[model samples]
Target: MKKPVAGDSPASSLSPCEIPKSLLPIFLKHIAAFIDSLNVVVLARLLPQSHHRRILTASTSAVAASLLSQRQHRLVLAISTPLLQPPAASTRPLLPPDNGIKKNVQGPTFMRKIWARDKQEAIQVEFNDLGQPIDEKSSSELAHFLGAIARNGRYAPLHYKNWIKVPQTYKKEMLTQVQEKFQLPPGQEDWILKSITKKWRNWKSFVKTNYYDPNVSLVEQMKNVPERVHEDQWKELVTFWNSDASKRVSDRNKVSRGHQKMVHRKGKMSFARVAEKKKKELGYYPSRSTLFIECYSKGETPGNEVASQAMVQNRVCLKSINDPTQIVAKGIVRSIDPSTEVGGSRLRPNWCEVHIQVAVEWDEELIRRYGMFETIGDALGAHVAWPLFLVERDESDD
Candidate 1:
């Protein structure tokens, strides 16, 4: 067989129906290659037949073509090119027949029947529109279905393999339960169950893989994001995991999504119970943080007040965050050399208490005990508050 010249109609030169079954795949492959090579303009010029135009419009639409990436759209248009040509002059009637059909009919009226028959053939052509898969159900139906499932608060159910293996009677029973819970449409139970199960498996896999480090601070971890996904997409995914939806889903499934878990404390507890008990017996009451407000004493106040205001001094211990009423020290604050190294770590904030003494300043104590020292310092070392603590005027009439 001779190779068809460029611009020649392959369908007109060779019979599409008469092609040998063994050679059909090879022939289709050649056709596909030829179509892929042609540009949109060439394709538009080639497929002048009305039925071909309709097929192009129905399947590989202009909207679909435009949605695809430049390279993909070009291929879409090329594949839409027509296969056959207009009928020959010889095939036309020599004289007017009793038949009512007109002589000047459009391209290949005889081939129109063949085109209709080819439509039934098991030829699968797909066009990527860069859109979600076509949904047989309406948007409203889908939304309603999803809303029903969400109301139940049950997500990420069992696998599809398990779902498929269950006996038809059991499947029906499960579907009935789902239907009652979700208030789904009567006949849609099976579809809803399958959709829910498949989606649950997918969601489970996604959450399982994407759960970031629980140990690392979220703020620090965000500095170096994953490279696999787009920046915006990664941010969105992070936001989603941080959202209540992720929490609810994880809680329902008893799975950890790597988010920070909140611990609930019923009451405040001291760091050293026995020591605190002994101190309490010694007439040392827990000093409330709110009561020990950093107050401006009108005139030149002590170095401690100045240091506290500057956030260079922290009198309260580590346990103070939970119970600010614990461990209160009273002393005058003074600026220190931050450059001076202390145990291989610099005194970063450069503020310390001078004249060195811990005074029992709270009025609640019946006995005021004072500790005399050369240079009093917090054994816990420098602690700075990122969020500035509240300071108020001493408000004394004096």
Candidate 2:
């Protein structure tokens, strides 16, 4: 009689006592192999049909050969086709359902450790005058001192345009604090104060521009800003930018004729260009009208505060300096910046300046009827590019 393979039923109607005990182990082994083959088929079915069929066929043939005691057949089946093989790594889902909970618990911790390592490399950890690490306490104390000086105004030089360039008094005060508190030598104290000042200003500038939340504390903001640059490291970067090799490259680029002139076209040419061309053909140059006034100064009138407030609201009226009643043109205040030194060695006003973008409009019928220059020259292109230059006036201004 042929020996029954794994998982085969006993053909004879017999009890367990009737079966040979020696065959029990073989029966169990075959049963386990049969179950494993079933599992392989079930998992392989998750793959594409062709892959699933190939894996199933190879696995079943190998199992059958093993049960039949055909070693050569089993080896051939295993070697010829990758039967009973694990699924492709690419095919396997990265986030398996069984591991989802474990991944959720551990993923953030792993990422945090990685980010911390990267940050440590990027930041220059600061040290106090006495070679102690300047921690949160030191930064807070420095901020308080700086804030006090700013409130006092005279020693702080907060009113100065170049306020960030630490004044002598500010430096002296910082040095005194560092010497008394940190107990370092005068030179070391000076160094620490300078480094801290640079760090503070850099942090403040970033916080002012980026962090819009008014409720956020300054301490928190400073903590979140990037670490202070070491003096030596900053010098390295400066040297690189100002290197002789860099200068030579810049000079060569300036002399090179290979660069193309880039014309930025926002839209079609302005109507003024067409009108101007038409006038030129008729042997007439277009009449000039002061249609726009960009920068206007009302010299130190009604104090800086009042002037700035008015400018912000766009309340200032701009009429012709020559003939105010003529209403040659009007200006809508676009922005106002505190007056800084301009004209590079010529005279400069200390007062704030109103920066206005002009309001110019031309009736299409009027322009066509006049057959001439009712509007100004195209700022963007040859055509009267009014849309590009013109900004809608505020309803209140109207």
Candidate 3:
């Protein structure tokens, strides 16, 4: 059927229906809603026809949550409600745009979006402009300190499998306080602060063990420190420096994660007694470790007795870590060097303390080295390498 077209005139150039410019917003909103394919309701009444949005996308945003910014509210709604409709039958896998994308945003990542929006939003905040770089000595000192830290074995995060967050034992900006107090000019202040931070880092690394050592007294640092204006401030410093509650929390989380990895379906029941388990509560303690060993001959078979005794010997080696593991005195036969003899007993055996006087060879100059027994046990389980008899000296025999 032939239909009559509009006559050639100014009216004809215009769209015949002429969806009004005034109505464009209303129509476009409906279109977006249709494209989104969500249940949308159009409100015609509230703010007169001029300002009214056609389709109010049903938001899950709560009233209180929207106080921060409308964008947050929008994001909550956008995420909570799936925007894309499922493919009818067969299509590419449904994915939100940019599911796995890296963003190199400056400032805080969490606040990046907000800042982008409210860059013009006026608010006053004070910031001490950073001091400029000063003499090369400061820079050199800082560099040296940082390098030393990297070389230090004490702060070995490598020892831990997880990203053990080395507690911020030394603050980078703390030196700024001293610098500022001394009224050193900007350049010098920067240099000094930088230097102090470097020194702190270097010291941490050289120690070979973390600041979390039980024997290292944090409170003692306070004793050496000069008289301070506020004692409370000193206490706070000591509290954090001495006890790395943050790192401890992190270590626990790492252990928890490791434990979560082993989900037993239905597994072996232990024959080891509850008391034994309680007594030697092995594994998953703070910085705790498990060592399993089978020892006989280095090249051939080490007898069961030898392996069994190795467990006790293993305990001795771990003890050295508590002190220093340079020596192993366990199970050595040597003559008493002392001229004086005991009145009651005539024997001073050359045997050293398993932990103390050393007869066994140990090579611990740099990297951690364990005793022969401890090393073997760390490799083999006690059940596999246990000795039948680990004899103790009888008083009667003595």
Candidate 4:
């Protein structure tokens, strides 16, 4: 009898009893499947009558060798193939039906925290405020926003022609004009680059080696040399005009030249320019004609009380000359002598002045029958108040 190798013994073969005595009760005394294999080795040396001895001896040797070789091959395959495969997972599923019952239930509620009902409530309140009320603003404020032109018409309009200097924004566009106007000779780009490179090449290497050397301080000395050639995959342009880096100081000359003669295309207004020229030639600017008028209304003219009431009503939108905080008509308007000098300066009248005596809230205006230009305040200081009246003619005036 030949001894079986490790698992190839009778234990791997079918036994008389498949159901063990200990497992018989749980398995209900049933028979389980059995493993059975055949191993045969036969050799017979009969008479040399039919050459049976020679054939059987050769066949036996061949079969035994083949079986041993097959076993060795199987062993090698099982050992070597495992080395080629990936490592087994750390944790394996339980056998049979254990996997069906296993599950992990504890995990963070990441999405639920961000999308809570409280967040939706906050957004609802925010959207409700879109229907809030707005207060009504004053019309005078709107007038100021529209570039209100005072009714006095004392000054001229601010047109482009009045400009004498260039605005800052237009200066940036002047560079294009310079390139079109000043073209270099043929191969100038190559020439300029080569010339600059040759002159500064040695200086570049020197700076790289002794960058902090007190002798070479200028950035110009550190640029465009052998070391600054940027062979590595790093920034090569530490200078201006190199890699959009700030060359503001070094490009000063080039940029200044580019902006040469750069100015706003504001043409001089012929009338305004000529006005000053004429003034210079005549030794002085021209002045407006003096307005001398005496108001003398008669025949069923309004009484002092009614006239004063109308005058106050006309100046309802008026502001105080001395202090804007104190209102005019609302404060008080009492009758005073036309020649009365309050604080040494006589009160003057404008074209709107009427001959009436009554009071509203502020200053008293004693109506004057006659008025002169010289009685007004300082003309240079712009304190002289006057109405730019458009006279309405009545039949009686002719």
Candidate 5:
């Protein structure tokens, strides 16, 4: 007769098949070894082909040895009869069937930890002498602060063109609140005030566009006013909207908007964010020309005729400039003082005094480079052709 497997023993007359307590430890050890060897073989398959042969051989040997040892001890017991038999109803306790829902006992602890971490990070943020945070989080926080002020009805009717027209007491209160919350330096008071004023104006415009309807009567429009705004303030806003002066201003703005040739396709993305994204992609901050092209162009082509001409002119200007750094320095100075004349008759205010000096300098340069011009205006107009080059020259000397 064929020999039975070591684990396949005849039924004992005394009791059910149970491993001896003394041999239980040894049985578990062998089972663990067998599992570990199988895991090793699985891992071996993932290794390089050269290492696989050696690793698999060692694991297979271990598996075979563990099986042999287990068989000798009859540790791989098959208690098939017990597995097939059902437990007595009285022996097993009655319990409800499990569904997948679980209680979130650790939720409060997790939220507290998150809050603490955010608080710690906020404390660690650094700021410049100007009170501007060096980190991006502070920018987001400032935006949130401005948004809160914008949403508050107490600071409504931001119709004044100049920030100076706002009440002094209100400005002081806002300044004090900003200083307390953001730790703003005294130097940044003007900047903070301007930012707040701009936000308020924008919020006012948003409310007017989204809530007010000119077709509806003043009373009907008043009903649509935001709950945060007082009824009196809403009536004043409606009165302003219906005024002849406001209508004239609106018509002028529509005319000015129609003259705009280039549309900003970059949407709401700031130039800073665009530069940052480009830096990540290209592994460095892009040059002004590269940034302009990337931002204003679609793929290889310029977005519009104006952008196309600007790029062509920029290339010409880059060639004309002997020292590129001068261009950057002059650009910075021009930005700080928009009244600074830059070799163009753009009819800017405060340009008369600066323009005379600029014209004289350009006249000499134009004569030396491109022969004589008919008049100072002719020389200045010629300078505009190389707009990027002549604009950088220092004409600060009176």
Candidate 6:
């Protein structure tokens, strides 16, 4: 006998019609039951009505008979329910239908283009051979130059671990670059250098605060280096930041900051801006005390006890100086220039003490010539004040 091949298996040889008569009904019933068990409603909802009808029409006679007998009610319900009910109202708002041609949308890119154009127009400046702008006094031009230097690899001051430790050559080079870009006055170079140093220190502090986590490993922290900083520099910084020395120094500085009593609420507004505003409002520049009160206090009272006490003392001193009984000789000198006096510039008007001898004879000629003072220290030049006590001592009776 020939060996049975793979396709000659008993099950594979049996066709649908070749199955035993008794089991044929059972097989068809099982197949029909399986079709009925399926989520036909979901399928009917997803498919078009024509396709759903075609599926039912294509079924074998035996299976169809079984389906009609067992699931006739279900088939009618599934098919009719979808047709009877309208589709759920879409929650989303209707957008304008898309055309074949794509239109250019005014999004971030368009806004960026507008901003770039505005910035270019706003910061227009003529550059010299050294690439410095002609308009040195223009703050916008100066800001542009500074921004360029910050991005340039040649300016190494910004990358230094410690600004104080940065070499003088690097600082001089940066100053020279700034000078070449703008015509800086003689003493203004120092101011520029100081400003740059402050910016660098602030940037480093920002990096330490945001990126340097004490709990994280140095290598891991270095991975999160700021885009402006070099990887090697950031690695070194992270290593240093992780050191005990850095932590100790940071803790000490934090403690020192905590001890500070009088903090200003002026925010980013500088004293110069405050003075300018006050000058505009009052028709003259405000005194340092007035500026202090404006910066550190709300209304007339100061924020802290120390500042409040100082303000009170200041008022008392001013009142006493203005009193006729406390008046002594005036116009003894043509003018008192605080800048010319030794350590005179350091004195504050409110802190000064004045000892008056009410019993002693006043200088009649001096008092008559000067007349009553309009304001305390008004006789003195602008920004000048008597910060010391004037005690009258008589040598005739002694």
lDDT of each: 0.36, 0.36, 0.32, 0.27, 0.46, 0.47
Per-residue CA lDDT of model 4 for 73-98, tens digit only, reads: 34433443222222122111111234
Taking all chains together, the TM-score of candidate 4 against the true structure is 0.14
How do all the candidates rank in terms of lDDT, highest first? 6, 5, 2, 1, 3, 4
Evaluate model 5: give its TM-score.
Answer: 0.43
Write candidate 5's Cα lDDT for 1-398 as tens digits: 34555776575322323667888889888976676565454444434344455555653433322222122213222321111112111111111223766544321011222223332243233445445444456555665575556445555345444357667877777665555555444477776676677777767776676566788887677655453455577777877888888889878988997855444557645455567678789998777655554555554343644433332112221111233332211111122122433443341321111122224323222212234443444554333222221232232421
TM-score of each model, paired residue for residue:
0.18, 0.18, 0.18, 0.14, 0.43, 0.42
- Which ranges of candidate 1 are over 4 A from the true structure? 1-22, 26-327, 330-332, 338-351, 354-371, 374-398
CA deviation > 4 Å runs, candidate 2: 1-13, 57-398
Cα misplacement distance, residue 158 of candidate 3 (Å): 17
lDDT of 6 by residue, 1-398 (tens): 34557869876665677678999889988876565535354445544453467446634322222222123434554554322222122111112335766765432111222123332244334433333333434644465455445434357544455767888888788777666555444556655666566656665776666556788776567666554456677778888777789889999999997855555667745455566667689998676656665665544233553333332113222112233235333221112222243223333322222222231223222211123433333333322233222211122323
| Model 2, span 106-190: residue lDDT tens | 2101122212333224323244334433444444343344333333333333223234565677767755543443333334564
Residue runs of model 5 more than 4 Å from their true location after superposition: 1-134, 156-162, 262-300, 303-305, 308-398
- Pairs in clash, predicted candidate 5: none
- Model 2, 320: alpha-carbon shift in Å? 31
